[model samples]
Target chain A: MEPIMAIVVGLLYAAAIYMMLRRSIVKLVIGLMLLSNAANLLIFTSAGMSRGAPPLIPLGSALPDGPVADPLPQALILTAIVIAFGVLAFAVVLIHRAYNIIRTDNLDQMKDTDT
Target chain B: MSLEVALPVIIPLLTGTFCVMLWRHNVIQRVLSLVGSIALLASSIWLMVSVLREGHVVMYMGNWVAPYGITLVGDMLSAIMVVLTGMMAVAIAIFSLSSASKSHERFGYYPLMHLLLAGVAGSFLTGDIFNLFVWFEVMLIASFALLILGGERAQMEGAVKYVTLNLLSSAIFLSAIGLLYGITGTLNFADISVKLAAAEHTGMVDVIAVMFMISFGIKAAAFPLFFWLPASYHTGPVAVSALFAGLLTKVGVYALFRVFTLIFNQNPDFTHELLLWVAVGTMLTGVLGAAAQFEFRRILSFHIVSQIGYMILGLALFTPLAIIGGVFYIMHHIIVKTNLFLISGITHRLLGTYDLKRLGGMYKARPFLSILFLIPALSLAGIPPLSGFFAKFIIIKAGIEVEAWFVTFVALLVGLLTLYSMIKIWAEVFWKKLPEGIDPTPLKEGKTSGSLAVLYLPVVLLAACTLVIGLHGQPIYEWAEFSASQLLNPEGYIDAVLGGNRP
Candidate 1:
């Protein structure tokens, strides 16, 4: 399960870099989404996978009876997801603004600031 | 035990909430922000005093113990950083009140300003790596909104690259944190410092260190990764630009200093040595880039990268005096660079442009502003009797002591080139006459002295800071010496964080 997840994370990252390198403005957004998702999955997989055991402790017990999944990674993942979502939402709006103002969907055309 | 440590984050968080609540009343929001900034400044100073009296302040969230719960640790370095953030906040709050346009006020700028401050303070305070990510996002989101608030065409253009590149860096940072946690099985800084030192997988740890370096490097705007900064920083409102210039990259440098000094010290040969070469690249490319720029703000933006290199150079040297120099460099750079940005704003106000070619005759028209500009400019160029002189001198001396002769030579060469760029702006913006048909009258003409005084107040205050830090270098040097020791030895930090949270 760990190896499979790692493969999937690698694919996501590969795709993200590919998408990000494209000149089209929209691909960049897609790339960003993939990149964040890859990072989230990387966290999930790298922490070592467990079966369906929850992070919760048994009632009145200080510790779980069996090997429970690591809860901290999940919490970190949830935080990462929310932050990435907020950033992505803002990025979409910004890309829309760039499109409207720069009058082109090409990232190449956004070079007005470079000169 | 940790109440003061919490105040820096809490004050800004509460104030930001109030700014949001008073969203409809722009003037009131500005007043609230000013009051809140003063409160934050007070709290940060109090935190500094308490840290001086006592040693390392640590707080665990919800009373959870270390290695399991989030921690906030205030060592000497983080304490001083919070103080700097508070000072910049107060200055920027006052500057924005008089300078920010109606549309900016209408668009909830104060709330975002406070939010960014909260994130910056939180970043300085947090003891957990993952928690640092949350704060970084908070800062990034607010800065993103602030950058494109006006939605100018060029802003939209600059913000795109800025947003995308920063998002990528955040992704890299998040992935790095995840990997580190996997190896150490702990998220707490001190806990990881202990565990990773004992861990058998030394090579993997170095890999993660590089990841951290690359991500934080982008945030710090280092060489080859600094393209986003020069493109985007000058597009924002002057208040946003100045605040970002002062606080944002310094936060990145702070993190670098913290982690490299604390958790990543096991392989200084790999990490610190790498930083040494990167620092050289950063200095040369940044100064050369600035020398080529025709725009006033762009040159300043490029110089931010070069100065950042000096700070990292100090860190990379990894000696007692070098670390002291690094700490002092950040302190001096933040105040001086922010002051320079504020001066540029006044220049923009007077001349109605940021283009160097079109700007001229400020020496004749506004001698005071010219004088204001020269202070930070000369300081940045490493002129004597200024903060930059001490900062550069300490680092270069350390570099030579360590026999990093090439780096020392590059440092001196960069200092000379920095002078060239500063003189370029001084010549074009002050000595040369204004282009034909240009009125030298400021855009906001006939303003009462009260409002005009408001405009000059923050710049004057920061200039005073530069002078004070220059002339009275002993106290600040002492503070940096203590902070350098703290970074060089993290046993105390680890002990406090691992000692468990106490009331």
Candidate 2:
């Protein structure tokens, strides 16, 4: 089950990369959204999949010997998700402003400023 | 107190927040920002002295131990960089007081500037890779705001490319961090070094290293990833351009120096060779690009790329002297490059154009400005008795010592072309006859008050420091050598964080 989840996450990353290569501005934003999700998933999957029990160990209790999911990656991924969300919001507003001013969604048309 | 270690970051953070509140009162914002920048400069100087005297200083947030929490480390490299950033910030702040237009001033420019500075200092002083990424975002967001602060058509157009490329780099950087954390199971840089030392997965480590390099390379404006820089840098106001040119990309270079020397020392052959080629290509392409530009700001923008090659060349050599050379080059370029940009600002205000072909005979009108521009331009061209010459001399010496003949040849050739570009600007903009229909009356009409002179003072002071450091290069050289030694040995950094090796 864990391997299947990893495969699904990998496919999301592939789809994100594909959308990122599109010429339209809207697709680019979607691509960034998908890519960020894929990154979050990558962090989640890399810590090893566990289904046995929660990572919390009660005080005054003997440590469980069974496998437990690593909480560190989850914590890291949560932080990353918040950061990505902030970045995506900023990117979306920036692209919207760009579209409004330049009056075009084509990335190729936006290439006029490159010297 | 050791609390001085955090001043560079804290001052700017507080000032940025303050500026947001004082956004309506332009005068108060300017005055407060000026005071804040001066305070930051003083603190940075104190921190530099403390680091030089006491050696490496590490500050862990909330008393958290290394490998378990975030740490900010201040060594000589970061200390020097912080000082440089402070100096540039203060200079640009002073310049902006009188130069910034009503629109730019009203839109929270002071706050954004300080925010940008805080982000830069944070990125430099951070000891953890993930924290570095966070600071990169901090700086990026501030820059995005500042870039479009004008809302001009050109600015908007430039912001799209600038923000897009930067966002892409940020994404790449995040992926790299995720990969690194997965492999090492620790975000602390010092611990990662120890873990990487014992790891057996050389191939995977190499892949991660490339990811880090590409991400930073894009930010640093290295050859293949530098297209966005020139396009955007010229579109902003002078203060913004000066600060961005002086400090931003160097943060990227600083990160490259930190990561490559500390954790990724496992595979030097592939990484170093690739850097060498990039250095050569960046230098050649940047100079040729400058040669084709007739506008003053555009020419300066291209020079930023060309000068970056020198720093990258030092990294490629991967020796103590070469690294020292890289550090010194960073300091020199920040001061000299920024002075040139500020001088361009002065010229633009006086002449009403940045185009060299449309302007001339400025030497007679503004001799002080001419001198200001000449010193940095000559320094940039690697003339003897200036900081730029010594920077190039050290790198070229290191290259020959290592017997990297091709890189040495490219450095020399780049220096000559740099001189050509400088002389071209001088001949056209200062020596030729002043273009008709342009009033020279601005110089004669305006008051030579101290307030107006205050703007030029920062650049003049920076240029003087460049000359002073060049003539008295020994102390700086020694400091760079000391920092290089610390960087080459990660044990001191690691022990400070993880509290010595665990049994």
On DockQ, the candidate that comes out on top is: 1
Candidate 2's C-alpha runs over 4 A off are: A1-10, A61-67, B447-451, B501-503
Q: Let me know the DockQ for model 1.
A: 0.86
Candidate 2 chain A: worst 10 consecutive residues by lDDT? Answer: A43-52
Q: Residues B211-254, candidate 1, lDDT per residue (tens digit)?
A: 99999999999877999999999999988999999999998999
Across A1-115, the per-residue lDDT of candidate 2 in tens digits comes to 7688689888988898888789998898898888878777877776566776797777787885566777887877788788888878877888888888889888878765577
Per-prediction DockQ, in order?
A: 0.86, 0.56
TM-score for each candidate, following the candidate numbering: 0.98, 0.96
Q: What clash pairs does model 2 have?
A: none
**RMSD of model 1 against the true structure:** 1.7
Clashes of 2: 0
Clashing pairs in 1: none
Model 2: residue A10 alpha-carbon error in angstroms: 4.1
List fnat per candidate, in order. 0.84, 0.40
